[model samples]
Target: MITDMTQGNPTKTIIKFAFPFLVGNLFQQLYNIVDSVVVGRFIGTDALAAVGSSFMIMNFFSFVIIGLCMGSSAVYSFFFGKKDYVSLRKSVFISFFSIGIFTIVLSILIILNTNNMLLLIKTPQSILEGSQDYLEIIFGGLIFVFLFNACSALIRSVGDSKTPLYFLILSAAINIVLDLVFVVEFNMNVEGVAIATVIAQAVSSILCFIYAFIKIPLIRLHREDMVFDREISTMVAKYSILTSLQQSIMTFGMVCVQGIVNTFGPDTIAAFTAAGKIDSIAYLPVQDFGNAFSTYIAQNKGAKNNERIHEGVKSAARTIIVFCLVLSTLIFINSENLMRIFVKANESNVINLGVEYLTIISVFYMLIGFLFMFYGYFRGIGALNISLVLTVISLGTRVLMAYVLSSIPTLGQRGIWWSVPLGWALADSVGLIIYKRLK
Candidate 1:
């Protein structure tokens, strides 16, 4: 097997790189699916809504990790492309040190003011206690999340996507079993679900770290590698911080959107949550490809091969278009059947609402593919600033629309849901235009 990411045809290279990433992503989503199922099936809709609402808050934290890790990955990719093993090691070490400091600060802030922050979000009192409980546990386990992401990011940066996938699969299986035992058999409710996720993530992080430290020779750190190079470290930090800002802004925008969803009561929240999961599943392919393209472009950029970078962007765009066309067609064809899998309401209102929202969003799914491709391409080239600017604009549009559009009586909740695809399409158009001019 061609394990190292540096050698291969761009198309084959990306496919090879993307396969495990796809699997890992699937397992990751399982974490969400398991939580939703257990909550909806055992604890009831309000409980499910609590889990969903808390998820938006958690997603913001997720974006921070993604930003930092992506920045590190890009730097590592450049070093890997140049075949500068020493520089790659230094980049990884500096990144690990930086993330430890950053996560500790964030964890302290979260633990100290969990209630205050929850109250600020206008989290409904009905679900407040449960959501708070879940958040507290998840927050405490922040290091595990960061540990997995940083290590996985570093490994993927050097082109070892498969190893991470293996661990993800193992941990996902553990999560499912734990969820059954704790939530289903024992009836521990939201806290049980939270415990399951943290434990699973911790396990994956430990296994991933062990695998990389022992098996993947590139990552084994030495004293010499621990010394950070100021220029490379600075460059990595600048790009990573911008990217992190972009992700945080996007998550913050979603929090605003969730506020809008909350106004409609738990039913709408449950429906929207279910619909969001379906959308995430549909998005997996394009997102998977987008992730692959980032590494692909990063490696090619490091080689200073401009045309291959262009090829990667074009290929990714085409793949996303095809994928959306198929997925949207399927959702349209069997919307009811799909929603039933998540939330099976006797009246079918929740599922119907979800299907309607999903159908509307599907219209613009192709635009998401374009946006991810453009962002990945630019980010790979260390032009992450462009990606950050685009995300800020995109997030701003979503938040403004959620506030203004959802209030319109005629559109109401539909508008709140509809704003999603519309925002993606509008923002993605800007990204494509910018990429065209820059490339």
Candidate 2:
């Protein structure tokens, strides 16, 4: 069992709690990276690009639920720290119901307009059919993704990161094997890969829910406890909707960025995808730490331990800065080699483009670390409005920059790519300023 309260040494406590989560997040990204590698190797570069191209679109839907998950975790952590079991259960139930409704509705909407959606994004004509097939299967199983994320978030709220890691590692391993069987052995194409990915998600969802159902007593709610509680529901909805709006805007902006990348051709698309995988690895630890700190800070805040909350901030900032320095160095040094490892030189032009993006972004990776840390920190403290404002600034700037830069003759696609780091630097600076006053 992972420990929740940091009795002393907040940094050590957060690091310990976050290690399993870091591993879990890495394993999750592994599914994406490995799936792309297998498809690029066995099927073709076009197939790889098709799958990668659809990621932000998929995330657009998923992030709505993710917002609720993040919001619920903060609420649950608050209640759990106060030992208010009734409210905790209510929060959980309302979160599930809300997310369930949203997932079903959005999945249906995406499935119904699949062709139009793909065309709207200007998906390549050659790969459009494949992308549609992938989206259909993934949307069909969106509930699995929602439930898994909700359950995992709830569990982590109480400081049990290990269970989620267990499920992720198991499912990720299974996903890789299934990918080989479906795509390579049976020649399933993009649809096969997509199906395998969802099936694996289903398995993780079922296993994690079952574990929570049996072990987490809070989950076994009575009709009274599970009944819609207006106050809790309102709180969850308020924060979640705000968070969702911020994320939706961010996702919409990325979709625009994707459209820009698409215009650059498959080489740029494939390169962006491969570089993104490496970037995910670099940021994983800070993300996990931020996650852990969010719950830690929320719990401490609810308990009215102002000192503990401040301690957590210091610990998180220190850890994130160090993490940024280390990962940035590694990514900067071996970026070219990292891109090459994902795909063969003869098959994909991803290597050169990936190297360029990685090199440019590495300079601002530390800024991202600061941004995510403070974002989580504010969220944990129920300062959601502040977090949303930072997101608006960051995302708004990025989109405007991406739009203007994408038009420039000299910058072209690279200009869109540069927007990410620039946005991070600007956003983190603003976030840090606000956090300073709050601290």
Candidate 3:
């Protein structure tokens, strides 16, 4: 499964490797969007808002799992490039094992605080009970999220992005079918959506676990190969923890913004939720590419090719610009129709609010593209400090703007929407500075 990335045409190789990830990420997003769509249409807007308000919290831990797995994947990419299978497997096992332990405890703590946390986010009184039902189920299934990410990271680190995509498709299908059956047929609302997600994720995690252990020769560990290296663990931990903190910090800022949006009541929250899903899907292609670039850089870094890393970053930038231009244009023209994907006929205000948010965000889509590119570039090369600094700055800018702007009586809810681009602009500016100075 370990393909030689160091030998291929840089741009083609990067895109080829990243493409499955792009598709995989789309299916991944479907898991969330389908939930919103089903709940909004069948269960109503309040149910949709209940699920929406919890996105920041639900995703916070998911990001933690992803960041750590990403760090492990970096380690795997490095060692795989060096043909150091022993150390690669060891790091993989340790990371996989460690996150399993960590997520269980975290899940328990999160479940305990689910209600209070929703309260802190200012979830409306009407949506409170449904939010609790949804979040408790998600947090309890954190193990599925953690383990699947670990398995996928290890496999992809050795150049098998397609494998994960297969399982993602399987999971998406399962989640969609289950979403309909439980929510529509059984008259279950938020609980059905939550249960469907956990079940689908669990299946994917099991499949990934099976494939990695059976098909991937690199992961076929022996008793002797189980040597836990402290140095390797420490190094993996260094990258993983730092990246996790970076993601968590960014999510923390979004949670603050979610709190601001919540104050405007359920309709606005429902609107934000719907629009945010579209916004997330739009950014996903670049994220997958950024991740692809990271693996590309890690392997090439292991090969000692600094030039390829630079070339890859440039390649990623071109891809981002071209894609964003097209995507933003499409979204601008079809903003209303897109918003309708999650809102019903009666939810006209929700539709209008979503259109407003989507319009503002599209204008700065290119800026967001640049922001992701640098973040991906820095992360690929293990420029953890730089990545952390950019994310923190972006987070602070977003949080401050959310509070300061949204507090203005005139701006109110629109202020929450505008805060997004301001944060992105500031972050993009700083990231550009770093890229220019360093280059």
TM-score of each: 0.97, 0.97, 0.98
| Pairs of residues clashing in candidate 1 | none
lDDT of 1 by residue, 36-150 (tens): 9888887888888898889888888877977788778888888888788888888888988898789989987887887776677777889989888999998889898889988
lDDT of 2 by residue, 77-159 (tens): 88888878889888888888878898899889889998887788778888888888998998999999888988898898888
Q: Could you say which candidate leads in TM-score?
A: 3
* Winning model by lDDT: 3
lDDT of all the models against the reference?
0.82, 0.83, 0.87
RMSD of 3: 1.2
Candidate 1 stretches with Cα past 4 Å from truth are 1-7
Off by over 4 Å in 2: none
Name the 10 consecutive residues with the lowest summed lDDT in model 2: 1-10
Worst 10 residues of 3 by lDDT: 1-10
Task: Output the lDDT of residue 139, model 1.
Answer: 86
Model 2 steric clash pairs: none
Q: What is the lDDT of residue 22 in candidate 2?
A: 91
lDDT per residue (tens digit) for residues 89-178 in model 3: 888778877878888888889999999998888888999999999999998889999888888888888888899999999999999999
